[model samples]
Target: MSAGAPPVVTEIARPWWDALARGEVAVQSCSSCAGWVFYPRPFCPSCGGRDLAWRTVDPAATLYTWTVAEAPVSPHFAHLHRPVLAVAELGIGVRVPTTLVHADPDDVRIGMALTPVFDAGTYPGFTLLRYRPA
Candidate 1:
């Protein structure tokens, strides 16, 4: 099998992805309710507001949880050696699911400070957002 495929950039998420390409991590914020949103949606989940805007936020986050992948579930992941997958809660209260890189699985702990790692070389035309100890 081939390496993992890149994410498809949709119209709704283009700004967020574009920001990532520029080495800036951004999330959607509701203009009406001032709520933070992830996964890129047309409306705000907090107040069901249609007025939403992309906002740059601090890349710092707290590792909420994580798991280690010892074996490749697919050929795309064969290159990864015991990759650590983590869910981190950003400073803005958004929980982002991302890979934890440049870290030992054994050393990772809950509540550890993490910062964003944008892998622009991994996938052409797209940047893979990972995290590392801060």
Candidate 2:
């Protein structure tokens, strides 16, 4: 993985990627326990139920935690000179790993309200989900 690398779109995760491409967010929800699932999977991790469905969710989130990269942490991220990597917690309690965009790193804080930034064309065929202060 490197700069301009093609984003991975697996068959099982196609719905999530497609939704992002359309400027929306979609997550897998457990049909049995009503629990939410991120990082799409075939079965529900909560109830071990085989039935799962893609559900659209509000892209809004709260900043759970964040860090400003002084240098690339790994070769895979060598292109990002100084990215604000963050974990955002959605209202439904699912935490998404993303980059905080369009804000000063000094201003980023825990529990800050965040809005979705549908980053289209950055990865060629993919639209990455980023966040910014709301």
The estimated TM-scores of all candidates read: 0.93, 0.92
Per-residue lDDT of 73 in model 2: 86
lDDT by residue (tens digit), candidate 1, 1-134: 13587688899999988998999889999999898989899999889999988899888899999999989867889988898989989988899889998899989999999988988877778887889998
Each model's Cα RMSD: 1.8, 2.0
Residue 108 of model 1: what lDDT?
Answer: 95
Candidate 2, residues 60-127, lDDT tens digits: the string is 99999999999888777887768999999998899999998887998989999999999885777888
Ten residues in sequence with the least summed lDDT for candidate 1: 1-10
Error of 2 at 108 (Å): 0.6
Query: In order, how many clashes per candidate?
Result: 0, 0
User: Which stretches in model 2 have alpha-carbon errors above 4 Å?
Assistant: none
In order, the Cα lDDT scores of the candidates are 0.88, 0.89
